[model samples]
Target: MNTVLETIKNRRSIRSYLPEQISGDELETVLEAALWAPSGHNTQPWHFLVIQDKKKIDDMSSKTISLMKKSPVDWIQKLASREGYHLFHNAPTVIVISGRKSADPLLFPLADCSAAIQNLLLAAESLNIGTCWIGLSKFLFDVPEEVKTLSLPEGYHPVYSVALGYKKEQLRPTAPARKEGTVGWYRA
Candidate 1:
């Protein structure tokens, strides 16, 4: 199999991370890989806010935990209990992805940003760097003003964020097996 296929097959969502940081070059390479993903009409409707500051990480985590606590779901309550209120798994770096707020803002930008995240994850896998999609940033969707502080242009918004770093351990969970033929392909 080709290297790309191997990378995809081995790629895993990394939640646990070490205190070490990823080098500048490796970070750039991963970001570059993300930007190369196809965008709708080449709008490139995506913005990445790379947050490495410990304070900012803590702030975001606090907010996410607060929101999760408010959630009526029992699973979230249980998760917060075991995880101790911190989200993003204490990853050393967080990349916040956002885009413009258009009539179909989410549809295009979400897809684009998701693709970019996937590219970055694959790239990180190749470089032995680990990344996991972060839900903390998205939890702040309740407050639009905070999103603006991220320097997103007018109408722009944050779609998703991914945490990056050198993980101290591998997550024990494995990807669930794909159900083939779930989506039927038909030729008439």
Candidate 2:
């Protein structure tokens, strides 16, 4: 396999992390990779909010769990009620990716943001940094007050968050088995 393929195969969503923070250079490299991701109409409408404060990260996790406990989904409620369940898995840093609103109906900020997130994840993995794509943060984003705290620029809304830090375990987890019949090819 080639370099990109190898990196893609090795990358995993890491949940466990060491308390130590990642280096500034590593974080910057990851963010730069995100910025290079292809965007719709080259709008490049993504914004990154990097939060390194443990207090703020913990508070966001607590608030998100509180909201999750009120969810109608039984699994979500159960997960939220579980003891010692931190939303970001206690990573030392969290990056919130937001997308700018576009008037064009065909423009999809979420799709563009997702591509950026992929690049960020891959870059972090290449650097041997642990990362988890945090969809659960959406619970916090849904709240207007919580959104305001992020201080995002006008017309941009939170899309997703990523938890980043040094891996707690030196050993990487084995990849899960791939499902078959998911791929299709059209040939002329």
Candidate 3:
């Protein structure tokens, strides 16, 4: 099998991480991968906000959990109130990805952002780093004040975020059987 394909198959979403921070070089490599991700018309409408401050990361996690608690969805509320739950899973760093407002409106913004995110995730996985997409932080993007705290430039919108760090323990999740009936063929 191809090395890239093998890496993709082995990659898993890491939820637990060690307290040690990732080296600048490793983070840069991941960012470089993201920068090279395919974009519509080469708009490359993505900006990465890397937050390495432990205090700030913790604060964001706490705030996200607090907000989750108020969600009307039972699952979200319960999960938010559960003990030993951190939205970022105590990762040493968080990278917030934003889509540039100047991107062509006709082009796909979220899809472009997703491609960059996938590149970052795969790059981290290949480098022995762990990463998990913290979708729980999505709510924060809609809040103007919270967005300001990220210091994103004008005309940029937060799309998603990922927590990155060294794994605290080996993450070898049992392979679940893939669901069937999800594929289709259009060849005629």
Candidate 4:
């Protein structure tokens, strides 16, 4: 198998990370990979906001946890703790992905952003960096103004985010198992 294919297959969802920041060149490589993701009709509707400022990152996570703990759901409120989830799992950097506000097609924005993030994570893996996609923060969108605060367009909304850093522990990934009858072909 090709090196790229191996990297893709071996990559796992990293949950724990070291405190070191990714290097500038490695960061550029990951960003470049994201730019190459397939988009609908070449619309490329996705945009990324990279956050590395310590104070800002800390503030954002603290505020997010504060709000989430107020949720009526007991499970969610319990999980919104400063112990492990503070500063977005304590990763050194975060890339907030958003999409343009338009009516071309609703699914295009999400699909494009998803593929872009896959490329980013794969590229990060190749560079020995780890990335974890964090979707919980989207709850902040419950408030209208968070869109602008995240540097999104007036109407654009956040789609997802990826936390990036070096892995603190070895990620043990199980082999891919076969789906008994998942594959299908039809021609008539």
- What are the lDDT scores of the predictions, listed in order? 0.80, 0.95, 0.89, 0.81
Two-way lDDT contest, 3 vs 4, winner:
3
How do the residues 17-133 of candidate 4 rate in per-residue lDDT, one tens digit apiece? 788888888889999999999988888888888998877777777777888899888877888964677737788999988887677654578888999999999999888788888
lDDT of 2 by residue, 1-188 (tens): 88888889899989899999899999999999999999999999999999999999999999999999999999999999998999999999999999998889999999999999999999999999999999989999999999999999999999899999999987889889999999999999
Residue 144 lDDT in candidate 1 = 70
Best by lDDT: 2
Clashes per candidate (backbone, < 3 Å)? 4, 0, 0, 0
Select the stronger candidate by lDDT from 2 and 3: 2
Off by over 4 Å in 1: 104-107, 170-173
> How good is model 4 by TM-score?
0.85
Candidate 3's C-alpha runs over 4 A off are 102-104
Higher-ranked by TM-score: 1 or 4: 1
lDDT of 3 by residue, 107-128 (tens): 8877899999999999998998
Where does candidate 3 clash, by residue pair? Answer: none
Ten residues in sequence with the least summed lDDT for candidate 4: 139-148
TM accuracy, model 1:
0.89
- Cα lDDT of model 1 by residue, 1-188, tens digit: 99999999888888788878889999999999999999887878788889898788888778777777777888876776664556777888889888765576445777888888899999999998888887645667557766655676667677778888897776534877998878977799
lDDT (0-100) at residue 33 of candidate 2? 98
Task: State every prediction's TM-score relative to the real structure.
Answer: 0.89, 0.97, 0.95, 0.85
